[model samples]
Target: MSRIILLIAKFSAFMLFVAQVESNCPSKCDCNPYSWDMNQIDLDCHRAQLDTIPRNVPLTTAKADFSLNKLGLDPGFQLKLDHLHDLRNLDLSANFLESTHIKDIPDSVEILDLSANSLSELSLDDLPTNIRELNLAKNGIDSINGCSGESSIQSSSQIAIRFDYNAIPILTRDTFGNCSASFGYIDLSSNNLHTVEHNAFRGVIQKANDSLVIDMSYNKLEIVPFEAFQDAIFDMRGFEYFSLDLRKNPLLCSCNMSWIPMMLDYFQKMGLKGVIMGTCYGPEESAGRHLEELTKAEFKSCTEYSWLKAEIKARTEQRIMPFWQVCLVVLACPGLVATVVLIVGVRMHVKDYRRYRDYVVRKKRQIATQRRRHHFRASGAVGDVLLNSSIKNSQK
Candidate 1:
């Protein structure tokens, strides 16, 4: 009988300890039992207007929703979540906080929602390896630290990332290169995207399966460089469930875009899914025209309007000279004539001078020859006189 009383006292103490732990839930937060086990709970403190993480959060919580709260970089704010060893989904979105606070988030979390925050960047360390869904939409991020597809975010077998409505201005080459994991969906829509370099989505397409879905609509894109998708298209050639949404973007249509028709044909032959053709909104002639409906004559052999204008200008130049050019030619005619006349006159004068010099030289040569002939005659006469004088003296 004494042993039974001791057992009852011990059970009462254990029950009291559990009751105290349950009562430690944060104030103004709803904590519901997650399972039949009273020790596991789910905390929902969303929009709680709390400036700091509640100190009384139970360590047994499996999912925490502190979204829409005033959680900033306050001291130990993330420490509060780190204590929940079993946390799976953490929603800290709409908090207007930077993502730096969650750089070292618990690896137990699989779904992390940092959307609608003030994050300007996301480093590889900011992502947990086991994460399956990472929502960073509606942030101020201009670029992801390691979006070349080798980052920790893509280390998982399957993950969905929402990066829409960010401040990304461009997608460079190999932005998603060499990724090996399959993504369910990747959203880069509604950003400030202006240029997507060739091979920008290479790594993304390399790892994606047939069920890949990508949204890139509602941006400032003028064109989608087909070279960027060339390899991706080949990789997804036989994929019947591939989908790429590029609607509502202001893509210009011109000769450079002649490959669109070819791309559509390839997609049809491969039985690829999703919207493969979009409407053009530029090149005035092709504007308000769908890529699918554009005939080869209508869309092909098409040049930019600026190029057409230049061609017309060139043709006109070949036909008629501009007023300025005509004036310049008219003004230069007299000068040309005068230059030719001056050159002719100078040549004639130089010819005359040379002729005169040759005449003077010939006259000097003639005079010198005449003087030599006279000297030769006088020397011959003197020699003859000397010979006769010697003969007469000998006779005397």
Candidate 2:
């Protein structure tokens, strides 16, 4: 019957797929086909000390784990693996890779782990077009703009890029420039971050679709980039999805950060998931205080420059000199500079005057010399006229 023939055909196809999976897998790797979809396979080759990628992987491999190995450190490391047309997941962590090593990952890769390596550059153009989950933790990343180039290539997929435990110094407004829509989940924890400029999250939050959870904990951040998250300066409304974690930072929650409490209160009322925690690092009395614990009346004297004043005060207090003494030096510095400038100006004027005086002396001496010569010439002309008169008298 027709139904019997169809069943036989299905059985034959299943057997052929099983044979392919059994014969094509590398000897060191454990390869198996999915129970539901027999054609798709998973290859686990981790901890195998693989210096070279095995060319014997199944053509239907959907996931491959080649982590914990000193794989070939070439930009074209995976170029010849085109047989894995359905390869989606790849883990190459702990391979000590740089940006060049991952420049040519397969376009089919959706999840990639290049963590625990030595990557420094943060360009996303090296990523696969379909990358959704990218892990770059424990690297030496010192720059950003990862989402700034060809960023629309991953627009179809939500992003979860991790840059934890790096040496990233600062975050500017253009850090995530041109990021795709619905892009979210950036981890910047445990970095050498010193500052986050205002509107720093504008690039990543411009096209936020649902939730934007940023982990900026464990840095030297003195203040949050509040404008990009709460203020009307960027029209950042709909606060149900914006979650910022600022714990463990040496935050200077002073007057300028008076706006921090207001932002927390607004986000809380507007469906905040959890508490947005920020602790103070200075101002003597507020050193161990939390931003939420501050009374509203405490900020009566707070201004836009209050945090700056606190920073300056804190910096000056740390020096060997007293605050007033440092202020004296700072205030008297300009006067010292002015005195030097004045002295230099007086010396220049004195030098110019002396040069002019010498020139005048030389001119006077030249004039005296010319007057003597003119008197002598006049005397000589008189003598010549007298001689001519005497000659005429003698001739007469």
Candidate 3:
């Protein structure tokens, strides 16, 4: 009878432990049997018609998978998860979230999967410093906030961020300026990005401290600004090994592409391997020819004149031209004025001399006329006197 009682006691203890584990799970959830070995409860409640997260989650749970659930919690409900201090991994993918549930997340949560949701905009100011892995794929996020100055993510030693298929239109300056991570990768594919500003990846490259990979493919980008990749290498000591995947972009094939040749040469000389995955979107003939397969003849055929290139060259030449052009203009201006003044003075002097000569000629003509008149008067007087004497002698 004693042996039978001991066996019953052992069975009862086991049942009690099982009941305790089951009770720790939410009322509508199921606990995996194998997950108990790690002393953590793994609850799977996917596709459940849950509107809000259940408060009865097991305290010892380290990971929770709630993917594909209809748990469309109100924006206010994100703050409620702060109570779950022990959660390390939380998967809320495919729920079609609209915006951030709350401004802050639990500090203890490390890995967060919010992929395939409807998040349009998010701010990282409220995130805890201990966060490591963050998956935000398929969201409508257009840009990264606080990517410069003091608030940039200078180091992701414990953080990995993924942003794929978000349809981002443009990447502004300092977009990822301070991101620092030993091992980091950014996926900016299948978006509407047409331009990447200078310093767009400053934080990420700086934080990488020598290890980083950036996947920027399947976008509408026509040009990658030189400054965007200026200091973005793994290290400045030498050509650091880094990966850049630029595929499916509409590369404009023109003389403006001189920059492309220069950039490729720079990367090759630095011992870096960068891949250009797609062909050029040139004029009609070579619209979709791959860049790698293109020969020099084909490239020359596709190349066209670029006004921007001409303008740049013109401006550069103007900047470097000697100051003598300006100095010559300045020096010639006074000479031109002096020549005009001398010509005017000579004309005035000639007019004055002509007037004086005319006055002297008129005076001489007047004197000669007066002298003839006087001579005629004197002759007439003598004739009158001779006539009077002759008349008197005739009368006598």
Best by TM-score: 2
Q: In model 2, which range of ten residues has the least summed lDDT? A: 230-239
What lDDT score goes with residue 310 in model 2? Answer: 53
TM-score of each: 0.64, 0.68, 0.61
lDDT of each: 0.72, 0.72, 0.64
lDDT of 3 by residue, 86-111 (tens): 67778888885665652445667778
Task: Encode model 1's per-residue lDDT on 1-396: one tens digit a residue.
Answer: 999998898778667655665577788888776644445677889978988888878888878898887777554555356677788788989886776776667878889899988888776446765787889999998976544444555344556889999999988776656455556578989999888888776655543344567788888888886766666655664464656677788988776676666555545544566355567898898888886775445554455333433543564455567889999999999999999999999999999999999999878766765555555557688755754554454445
Local distance difference test, candidate 1: 0.72
- Model 2, position 381, has a per-residue lDDT of 81
Model 3 stretches astray by more than 4 angstroms = 1-19, 33-38, 73-76, 148-159, 180-183, 207-209, 234-241, 255-263, 283-396
Instruction: Report the Cα RMSD per candidate.
Output: 24.9, 21.4, 27.2
Residues 1-396 of candidate 2: C-alpha lDDT, one tens digit per residue: 999998999889888887888778898898877654447988889998887788777777889988998775555455356567798899988886677777667888889998987788777666777888889999888987646545645547457889999999988665665555445688999998888776566555543235677888999888775554532222334433665678898887677677665555444544444346667887888998877786646776767645543543453345346668879999999999999999999999999999999999878766765555555556688756755555455445
